[model samples]
Target: MSLRADLRVLWRSPGFRRLTWTRLLSQGGDGMFQVGIATAFFFDPTTATSPEQIAVGFAVLLAPFTLVGPFVGPLIDRWQRQRILLVGNLVRLVLAAGIITLVLADAPVWSLYATALLTLSVNRFLLAAMTAGLPQVVPAHQLLAANAVLPTLGTIAASVGGAIGGIATFVVPSVSDNSLAVTALICAGLAFGASSIAATRISRKELGPTHPLEKLDVGAQLRALTAELLEGERYLRARRTPWHALGVMSAQRLLYGLVFVASILASRSILADPDDAEAALGAFSIVLGFAAVGFGLAAVITPMLGDRVSRERWILICLGIGAVGQIVLATAPTAWALLTAAIIVSFAVQGGKIAVDTIVQRDTEDHVRGRAFTLYDMAYNVAFMSSAVVGGLILPDSGWSRPIMLGIAVVYVLVAIVFARTPHEVRPVPPRPVAN
Candidate 1:
C-alpha cells in the first residue's frame, strides 16, 4: 500500500488515532525537556566547559534508569497497559513539577538529577507500553504501515517540540536558565495532559496480554519475572530475523550515539560561542531543525522504499548511507558539514529504525512483546551510554576529533557489510505452554 492509503486507513481508526496523539504529545514533550537540558549543560559555559562535564551530565541522566528499566519490563506485560500509560504520564507530570522547583530554586545538581531520573525511569515504562500496545490498535496487515508512519511522525513531533523549546529561549525575554526551565515545565505539562486524556479514550483492557496472569507470592512473582525475562532472551535467540535485525539496529545506535555526542561538542565549541549559552543553543537548534527535515523525508520515503525491497535489504542500504554521513563529518567538520551530515544520518537512522521495529513486532508474540521492546530500549540506552563514555575518553575538549569521527564511519561500513551477510529468514519458535 502507498503511504497515503495507509495514512487514510489509520485516520479512520479512532483507537489508533488516539494512541498516535498520545505518543506524539509525550515524545514532543521529551524533545522540549531535552532541549531545556541541552541549553543548560551544553550551551552554558559555566556549567559545561569540558567534554568530561558533558559526559558526566549524560551519565547522571541515563545511568540509574538504564539499570532499573529492564527489571521492570515484565510488569508492563503483566499489568493492563492502558493504566500504565495513564499512571505513568501522571507520575512524569509530578516529577516534571519537581524538576521545575529545583531549577527555579537553583537547588543542588544532585537533586535536579534525581528528579530527572525518576521522570525518565517512568518514561521507559510508558514507551514500552506504547510500543507493545501498538498491535492492539491496528490490524495485522496494517502493522507495517502503522509502525512506519506512527514512529516517524512521533520523531517529527519530538523534533518540532525541541525546536519550539529552542525558540522559547529567545522569546521569553530572559535567556536565563530559569526561563529554559519554565519552558520545559510548560512542555511537560502539555505532554502529560494530552497523553493522559488520550489514554482515557481507550478502554482499560483494549491493549492487552489476553493471556492469563498467575497469582503468586512476592518471591514467586520475582521468580516468574526472572524466568519470563529469560524466556524472552531465549525467544530472541530462536528467531533469526528479529535477532539479526536487533543486532544490526543496536550496532547502528551505538555508532549513532558517538556521532550524537560529537555533534553536541561541535555545536558548543566550534560552531558557536562556548561562553554564550543562547548563541550556542541557537546554533545547535538549527542543526536539529535540519535533522528534523531529514526525519520528515525519511517518513515519506521509507514506506515507499519498503514496498520495493525486503526490509533487511533496505536496512543494509541505510547503514551504508549512514557511513557516508559519518565520513562527511570526519572530513569536513564545519557547521555546514555537520548540518549536512545530520540530515543524511537522521534519514538513515529513522529508516533503519522503522525496519527494525517492524521486524521485532511482526516476529514476536503479543504476550512477550512488552519485554521484547524493553530489551530493545535497553540496548538503545546502553549504546548511548557507551558513546558518552567513549566520547569522554577520546573527544578533545573542543569536541572535535577527526580520528574519532573517521573511526565511527569505518565501524558503520563494517557493520553494514556484516548485516548484509547475515541470514534473515523467519524461523518460528514453538510456543511454550503458559502456566494457568
Candidate 2:
C-alpha cells in the first residue's frame, strides 16, 4: 500500500491514534530529558571531568537494565499494558520532578543517579508497552505500515524535544547550572501533562496480549518467563541468519558507543570552553542535532533502499560507511568535522539496526517474537555499556585520541569483512515496525 493510504488508515483508527499520541508524548519527553541530563553531565563545568566519571554516568544510565530485563519482560506480559503505559508515565513524571529538585538542591551524586535510574527504568517499560500494544489497534495487514510510521514520528518528536531543550540552555541563564535543571523540570511537566491526556483517550484494555487462560500468580509468571527466554535463545541458535544479523548490530552499537564517548570528550574539553558548561552544552547540542538528522535520513532512505538490496549486503555497506566516517573524524577533529562524522556514523548504525530488525521479524515465529526482541534489546544495551567501560579505560579526559579513532575505523572494517565472509544467501525483507 502507498504511504498516504497507510496514514489514512491510521488516522481513521481511534485506537491507533491514541497509542501514537501516547508514544509521541513519552518519547518526546525522553529526548528533552536526555538533553537535560547531558547538560548537567557534560555541559556543566562543575560536574564535568574525567572519563571515569563519564563512564560511571553511562553505567548508571544503561548497565543496570541488564539485571532489570528478566523482571521487566515477565511483568510486561502479566500486567495490563494500557495500565502499564499510564502508570509508567506517571511514575516517570514523578521521577523527573525528583531529579529536578535534586539538581537544584545540589544533592549528592548518588541521589541523582538513583533518580535517573528509576526514571529510565520506567521509560523502558512504557516503550515496551507501546510496542506490545501496537498490533492491537491497527489491522493485521496494516501492521507493517503502522509500525513504520508511528515510531518514526515518535522519534522525530524526540529529536524536536531535544532540540528545544538545547535551545533552552542558550536562552536561559547561559552560565548557570540551574538553567539545565530548569529545562529538566519543564520537560518533566510536559511528560506529565501529555501522558495524562493521552491516557484518557484510550480504553484500559485496548492494547494487550491479555493471556486469558494463564494463571496470574507471580511464581507462574516467573517460571513462564524463564522458559520463554530460553526458548528465544534456542530459536536464535537455530537461525543463523537472524543470529548473525544481531551480531552485526551488536558490534555496530559497541563501536557507536566508543565513538560517542570520543564525541563527549571532544565536546567537553576540546571544542568549547572546558569550564564553560553552557558553551560545551551548546556545541554538543548542535552535534546532537546533526546526529538526529542522520538518524532521520536513515529512516527515510531505508524504506527506499530496503527492497532494492539484500539485508546482508546493506549491513556491510553501512559498516563501510561507519568506517569511512571514523577516518573523516580522525583526520579533521573539529566541531564541523564531528558533525560530519556524526551524520555518517549515525546513519550507518541506524541502517544496520533497521536491517537486523527486519531479519528478526522475517525469520522468527510470531508467538516468540516479543521474547526474541527482548533478548535483542539486551544485547545492544550490554554492548553499549561495555563500550563505555572500554572507552573509559582508553580515552583521555578530553575525549580525543587519534589512536582510538583509528582503532574504531579498523574494527568497523574488520567487522564488515567478517560479515561478508558469512555464507548466508541474501534475502530482501521489508522494513518492519519498530518502537523507540
Candidate 3:
C-alpha cells in the first residue's frame, strides 16, 4: 500500500488514533519543558557556555536513566500500560508546576535540576510504554507505516511546542530570563495536563502486555528483576535482526549527538554572539526548525519507500545521506551550511530510527517487547552521552572543527558500508493477538 493509504487505514483504527494523540501531546509537552530548562540552564546569560559544561549538563540529565532504565521494562511488562500512560503524565504535570515555582523563586540550580530530572525520568517510562504498546494498537502488517508516521508526527509536535516556548521567552518587553522561563514552564504544565487527559481517552486494556504476569511478592519481583533483564538480553541476542538493527541505530545516534553538541556550541558562539543569550537561543532555534523540517520530510519519504525496499537497505541510504550532510558542513562551516547539514542529518537520523523501531517492534515477541524497547532506550542514551563526552574533549568552544566534522562523515560512510555488508535479511515474526 502507498503511504497515504497506509495512514488512512491506521486512522480508521480508534486505538491507533488515541495512541497517536497521546504520543503527540506527551512529546509536545516534553519539547516545551525542555525549552524552559534550556533557556534557564544552557542559554542563560549567567551560565558558562562551554563544551565541557554542556557535556556535564547532558550527563546530569541522562546518566540517572542509564543506570535505572533496565529495571523499568519488567514493570512495564507486568503492569497495565494504559495506567502508566495516565499516571506518568499526571506526575509530570505536577513536576512542571514545581519547575515553574522554582524559576519564579530563584531556586538553587541543584534544586531545579533535581525537579527536572524527576520529570524526565518519568518521561522515560511514558515513552517506553508507548513504544511497547504500539503493536497492540495497529495490525502487525502496518507496523512500518505506523512507526514511520507516529514518531515523526510526535517529533513535529515537539518542535511546535518548543517554538511556542521560545516565543513565550520573548513575548514580554524587557522580560527577565527567569520570567521567560516561568512563562514557558506554565505552558509546559498545560501541555502535560492535556496529555494526561488524552491518555484517559484510551481504554484501560487497549494497550496491553497480552498475557498477564503471575502475581509475585514485591521482594520476589525485585529479586527476579535481574533474571528477567538477563532473559530479555538473551532473547534479543537470539534475534539477530533486531540486535543488528539496534547496533546500527546506536551508531547513528552517537554521530548525531556529536553533531548536536557542535550545533549548540556553534549557534551560541559562531552563529550568534556568545554574550547575547537571546540571540544564541534564536540561532539554535533556527537550527532546530530546519531539523524539524527534515524530520517531517523523512516521515513522508520513509513510508513511501518502505513498501518498495527493505528497511535495512533504507537505513543504509539514510547513513549515506548523513555522510553527505556532514561533508557539506565540514567543507563550508558557514551558517547556511550548518542549517543545510541540520536538515540532511536530521532526515537521515529520524529515517533510520523509524526503520529500527519497526524492526525491534516487529521481530521481538510482545511479552518481551517492553524489555526490548527499554534496552533500545538505554543504548540510545548511552551513545548520545558518550558522544557528548567525546565532543567535549575534541571540539573547540567555537564548535568549528573541520577535522571532527570530516571524521564524523567518515564514520557515517564506514558504518553504512559495514552494515550493508552484514547479512540482515528481512525476517517477519508472526504477529501476536491482542487481548480484548
> Which predicted model would earn the best TM-score?
3
Off by over 4 Å in 2: 1-16, 97-109, 132-149, 163-183, 199-207, 210-215, 421-436
TM values, all candidates = 0.92, 0.84, 0.92
RMSD for all candidates, in order, please.
Answer: 2.6, 5.1, 3.4
For residues 143-216, write the lDDT of model 3, one tens digit per residue.
88999888887888888888788787788554576787787778888888898899999998889988756574
Count of clashing residue pairs in every prediction: 0, 2, 0
lDDT by residue (tens digit), candidate 1, 148-267: 889877877878787777677677777674786677677766777788888898888888866535453666666677677778878887987888888888898888877778788788
Q: Tens digits of per-residue lDDT for model 2 on 253-285?
A: 999999888888788777887877877777776
Name the TM-score of candidate 2: 0.84
Off by over 4 Å in 1: 101-107, 163-180, 212-219, 433-436
Better of 1 and 3 by lDDT: 3
lDDT against true structure, model 1: 0.80
